[model samples]
Target: MPNGCDDQLPNRLARGGYSMRVRFQVQGLLLVLGILLSGIALAAKAPVLGEQLEYTLKFRGLVTGFVEMNIAKMTMAVEQEMGRVDENPAIVTDLHLTTEPYRKAEMIYPVRLHYRSWLDADKLHPLIAVKSLKTREEKEELLWFDHSQGEAYHYQSGELQAGSNSRPPKNLQGITALSDEQWENLLQAHQVSIGGIEALDYISFLHRLRSMPLKSGKQINFSTFNGKELNAYLVKVDQERLVRAGWNRPAFRVRMWEVDSESGRKGDDMVDLWLSDDNERLLLRFYAERAFGAMEGILETGRPTGGKDEGFSEATRSSLETYLGF
Candidate 1:
């Protein structure tokens, strides 16, 4: 439902490397957590809350030696209600991703999310849509454009005669057709970072942490409107053994720092992400180490051949099943 915390950032990252820095510090530490956990799971115990979830993203780096570049599997469903300020309010979240690579060929993206909270205009609106089907064939040659605030529209095939078409004729532009400041410097050198579903509340630790003095393995020092200054650390892994899928799942080790922002031209890379203390803190995996060789591929199966009417609604499926307690 967007509001994942706002600020929108994330496009994609991990490719080519050069800069490096890491520091650590720990003491006192008070608050920095963001809550968003649910409850209700007692069939055998171990499920405070859950509506519907599914994930499968395997990415092994190294183009020359360690292959496996793609494999995206996703299925999400969350709903909860009663919200003016709070009290368990989470609605709409139905994602279905199916990507493949390992060798080549495979793509499926079915996303539908809707969230609204006005409370008389307090502001909270998130609506994402990507569902087009007509038996494919590039869906008439493809043609959708949003670029962020163009609103939203996608075709990629044919049949979208508004005023006889003004600009929706790219066909299937690649490299995102560049030019948005060169696609935002190629999405900040692929370190990509677009609102991460709205930051999901920084990774919810039960919410309530905004002090900011820097503790728990401190390092801080941030900057990234393009100024680039990075250098952040703070670890606390252990959210139910981090669930698990592959690679054993248990890393968010945190404790990474790298600074160089006086205008030296180098700071488009920063990898260190792990957050899975269960309860749906979910992020659970991220590790990159590949400077230039680059050449990997992995993705075995994927479905959603056409697009199931692009779903969502029943009051956002009962508010994501009561904030994810499916």
Candidate 2:
């Protein structure tokens, strides 16, 4: 996310025509969102708390950033004005995303983000999501998702309130004249439907993708509510191949695109994902074509912090440690 929440880089903005500012946001979201890593075999049906997954983000083959995602069960006490207790089983995800320069330096990197998402443990629907980013300036975003009502609310705050001071469409400039796509985004902005398994953010979508039975040469379309706008993604399952990660084994190369994909259509600007084929199904490689170039990432480290081996193989666990040499 950019400091100027308005710099929606890859929000359907033409690829080659991206300004330097949009380029930064595109890289931020590409790395921040899909930096999500999950297993080939999810132990029970839901992720247990205290699970940590880390990935090394790269651009054009160079390590540029790192993303760490952690999950934990949170209990929210609904107090009566009289201080009564009402507990709920909720899971919260804390994500820390930062670039290489920030990691190696005392100063801040141009693109750095820290965000957390709280979801209903049983349903995997989000309750609240907050994100903070530091670029030319620092900005914070808050989103609340009401699945029952099928609506998501967004609030922006920061030292520099870039897009926060937006006026209604009638008073705002360029209301009558608009592109069809832009109009669609505007109309679906705040009001959205959560019917069935739709309205998922990319992080939630990644988790949901794991359970889906994606057979070879199959494609599935799903709706995603990206806080800023509503969009759809077409996920295509390509042939399987052996990709080297913690181990050299068979994996599925999945392609995803946010476009109007019709039958037998592969849309432009795709995101590529590789997941291990075995039951220990771990995320292996992630790649997405960005405005500047292709943004790439790989699983760097993963382990059950609870001193229990759910199913990760010895080779997979050991190989990750060797790859993270100091």
Candidate 3:
């Protein structure tokens, strides 16, 4: 009996050593360490605010292992809030990309988001205009839209409509007709003009950080226009190279670490954004974990062809300036 018990003990010990639980523990530990190291590296490169920046944004979406959708080109401009500007405004956003099908059709489109600000009573009001230009058979269809008072206005050909409307009046025919809801949906799906308000918030946060004195580990909370709060940790501050997602636009380089609250469900929901070591005026890169996998955006800058400057008004500029301290 004693010999039988001793023999069984060796087999039990061998089985326990190779258990699935043990293997899982090892993998989980490694994942945690990797995440920690990433945070540490980011902290070491945090930048101070108020630095001039220029960079480009490149967008690539992978549909399969070999299929990719490459956007043409994207550009961004960043400047410190001059007086009372609260948000970092996007001076220009030019999108140039071509979509290639697996075997057939390919299409190219140009999208632009231009902004200009002036001065208001005690705040800096920003006016953003989005334009999309598509050419077909020697005919160019130019479309424009603006957002105001929780509604968007569409101006194309020679007609205008207000509110959550999409199509212009029947009387205003032959013009490119698009509703606010439709345009918004298209941009969101294609991830174009995705950074409009978010980019503004990023700039405002940078300005605030720039004005503050340097510290080892400083944390700040920022709320977006949509009421989402993001927490930023100031790990390191100084000058560094910052890269963003676009085609050929200039991007500001800065050092910063921000953790944004997850919008949807709970489990492992977070969006992490990092600026380069230099304190330019734009976001360098952002990483988020979605239900499927991890996704990221890198800024690429480029030059724009000659076009009209349909930007913000002087009165709106005054309002934004007063509000943001530009």
Candidate 4:
């Protein structure tokens, strides 16, 4: 992840392959959708189906990327080994991310990534996550979550579709590309075991977190799948604060990190986040210590699904300026 796009995964995901990617090329898109998008029906503690949060991506001090979330009526088609399931009355989230040319760093052309997620209407479990990416490189990933059977399905685009710049490591033993006649057989869905893990894809993790009671000094731990590996994560409620966050609402200062419970050694990546202190629990701001300096996401503008822009309070803007050391 360090070499690739600094995707919206746990800050640790940055240690992967490529300079242009910090996140999963496919589910980095999927992760952001889960991490930031919300559903409308479940109540205020979780994201409403019609709510959308727009964010600005900053690296060091540059506004290099933009990401936005929009949740609408759930109407996407999803299929699994079991069969097709009707997602009517489901919750759907769409995410879009774009980055400007980092010409000075050899990252010339801009990049765009798109992701979609569908969740069950009542339980809010992830049904499927789909990703599409295009830049100097082309990659796609799709995820199927069948929690009922405790299984996960994954797919990564074959190298044939890989951009001239990216040659994904071969998972086919010593074989790389297969003949066209054998292509369909070669490109098969890979499976990861998640039978007992309470795993949430990147996007759905936030929803799960929102549903928790983050009382002061409480610690929450869970397992999450970042497509490739299933890792454990910890979210602790460090304390509560009275910052206005530009609005008059109170906020909670929380700490998040990865942990190896067996060894008890902490992870290198760390995240400090601010969430609304009320039932809404919006993720107001976060600063992640990643390989490439601090990756910051600030709320720029947002609205409920089908609603108009709900402007950010100037105080929130000023707080960001001060927090970023502007």
TM-scores, all models, native as reference: 0.21, 0.60, 0.33, 0.62
Query: Which residue runs of candidate 4 sit more than 4 Å off their true CA positions?
Result: 1-44, 61-89, 100-109, 160-186, 242-249, 302-326
What is candidate 1's lDDT per residue for 1-326, written digit by digit as tens? 11111111111112232111000000000001100111222111121223455544433222212233333444444434322222223233333444432222132222222211111111222222223222122221111222244332322223434443333323222212323332222111111232322211121111211111122243333222111212232232222222222323332333222345354333443344444323333333443322331111111123223433224322233335544564
Candidate order by lDDT, decreasing, is: 4, 2, 3, 1
lDDT of 3 by residue, 1-326 (tens): 00011223324434545334323432332222112101232222222223333332222111111112232232333324332212433332222322222111112222232322222212222233233433231111222222222322223332233342343233222222335443333321111132333222333333334333333243444332211222333333333223222222322223334344465223334444444332333345544332222333444322233423334222223334554575
Which lDDT value does model 2 have at 67?
19
Best by TM-score: 4
lDDT of 4 by residue, 152-204 (tens): 76666664433333322243212222343332323324566788777777666
Ranking by TM-score: 4, 2, 3, 1
lDDT accuracy of residue 180 in candidate 3 = 47
Each candidate: what lDDT? 0.26, 0.49, 0.29, 0.51
Write down the TM-score for model 4: 0.62
Deviation from native of the Cα of residue 66 in model 4, angstroms? 19
- lDDT for predicted candidate 3 compared with the true structure: 0.29
User: What TM-score should be assigned to candidate 1?
Assistant: 0.21
Clashes of 1: 47
Model 1 CA lDDT for position 279: 39
